[model samples]
Target: MKENLKRLFEYRELLFNLTRKEVKVKYKNSFLGFIWSLVTPLMMLVVFYVAFGVIFKLRAMDMKYYAFYLMAGILPWNFLSQTLTQGVASVVMNSDLVKKVYFPREVLPLSYLGSASFHFLLQEAMLIVFLLAFRVPLTPWIFMLPVLMLLEAVFIAGLTLLLSTLNVFFRDVQHFTEILLMAWFWMTPIVYPISQIRDNLPAWAAKLYMLNPMTHIVLMWQRITYNSPVNGPASYSMSPAGVIGTVACSLGLLIVGYVTFTRLEGRFAEFI
Candidate 1:
């Protein structure tokens, strides 16, 4: 682990190169370039806001519409989606680098994901501007944002390593992971609140929901976004148990992924 960290520190140049390359490739030929990130989430929020907030009049406590509710969900969801999608194909996509490079294999995927994570932060900065426009108060809990982002980075890095390594063994990893992400997205409380589903589903359903780490993280985000009482229900809320579970799961995945990738990395060039 120390050696891997040292190698990443030594190869910082390649890391920056990968991140810049990804940003360039993603925005290449696009008129708006990076603005496309804002467009995607904003359009999504509008559609859901109208459908659930306007058409259905579905409201969650004090959150009258989906826009406020969704920025919380969308931000975290986007990070997970982009990380998994890009990570799955990282090794296969960088077959050239994998075959020729002497550095850590995880760095490539980490760089791609690091770029995505930066974009997520950029999206959050945009969200904060919207929050101020709506007059959302600046509360003490807002300090938790950096802690959450660090936790999020660890989670993404772990998953990215797992999928990138797997893709070499199974070329279909990308296709299947997308389907998994879609199923996982719906499993999360994106379009509606947990209370909305609670009455409709059984206790078992709620337990199943906790299996999704994003469920806890997104809800916590919503609570912070609203500047409501921490770990308490007041127009917004979160289950401390749930968020703890998410962190535990994330760490477990990171350890598993790191071990698995290093174990299998030496064969990547031969397979790819």
Candidate 2:
């Protein structure tokens, strides 16, 4: 791990350049450019509002301001999902660099993380604007937003490292990741509240559901963004145990991912 850090430090400029390229390349040749980032979440917000609020009748249920609730949850969820979707292919997508370049391979995924994070910040800015427009009061809990986001970044970094390395060897890992993410997204409480999961599922099932790291992360986000009463789904509240679970799960993934990535990276060129 020290070696990886040292190498990354040495190639810090390359990492920055790559991250910048990732962001720019994404919007290249588009008149809207970065505006699409703002438009995308809005589009999803409408789709979710209709699907969950109108079609499913969540609007009459516990959720009051369904748009606010959905937007708050969707922003971070997009960051997590987009990072993994792009990061998983980072190694193979840049096979030429992997086979020929001498820089740390980990930077590839990290750069993707950085790019996704940048877009996430933009989406977050939009969310804040909507919150203000809706007249939602911000509170002290808002301070916890950065802490939760940091934990999420650590969690995603770990996954990216592990998956990108694996993809070099098993090309199918990329396709498999798409299916896994689809299941993972629904398993998370992005569209609905955790309360629904607890009320509907068996006790044992709910217990297992809480084990998902994203569960805690999403709850924490809601705790920060939607903690104030605004006639929305009951504001999510996380206990001390939930905090510990999130920290432990994130760190565990990081440790395992870093170990697996470094161990397998040596054979990356051969496979790619």
Candidate 3:
């Protein structure tokens, strides 16, 4: 791992260039340019707020500003989904670079992550603006956001490495990833609360549902935004044991994903 880190550092310039390229190409030839990053999330937030808040009244019924509440969760979900969608194809998409250049293939996904992260932060700025506009009080729990975001990034990075490497051999992995993410987006409480699952699902099934690391991650985000701002006591539906289990699960996936990537990467050039 030390050697790999050292090599990546040696190629840091390439990493930056790739990340810049990814960010630029994303908005290139578009009239709106980077503004779309903020607009996309805002558009979705409006649609969701209208659909769930106005039409169905499905959000935290107690909260007055459902748009802000929905934006908070949606921004993070956008980051994760974007990272995975691009990361899954990072290797195959950049096959020319992989073949011509001699750098760590892992950097492709990392660079994509860097670009997505840039966009994530931009979207978050809009979320903060919404908070201020809605007069949502900022609480000390907002400090915990960095921790949750870090864990979520680590989780995505591991998956990126694992999926990018696998897609090189089995091209179907890329297509399958889209379906998986679609299902995952709904599975995670992006638009709705986790309580709905507990109320509707059997005890065993609810327990299984909470087993998803994203469940805790999303709940933590909702807790920080919804509960903390109102000075409502911090609460997570997942037990302490469940939280620990999810953290352990994320760490394990990181380790296993890295190991798997390194093992499979030897043949990436041949397959690509």
TM-scores of the candidates in the order shown: 0.91, 0.95, 0.92
lDDT of 2 by residue, 80-170 (tens): 9899999999999998999997777888998999999999988887887778888887656887777778899999999988888888878
Return the clash pairs for model 3, or none.
none
lDDT of each: 0.79, 0.85, 0.79
Model 3: how far residue 257 lies from native, Å: 1.6
The per-prediction tally of clashing pairs is 0, 0, 0
Q: Is candidate 1 or candidate 3 better by TM-score?
A: 3
Per-residue lDDT over 190-247 for candidate 1, one digit per residue giving the tens place of the 0 to 100 score: 7777666566788897678667777777776776664333223643345667777889
The TM-score between candidate 1 and the true structure equals: 0.91
- Where does candidate 1 clash, by residue pair? none
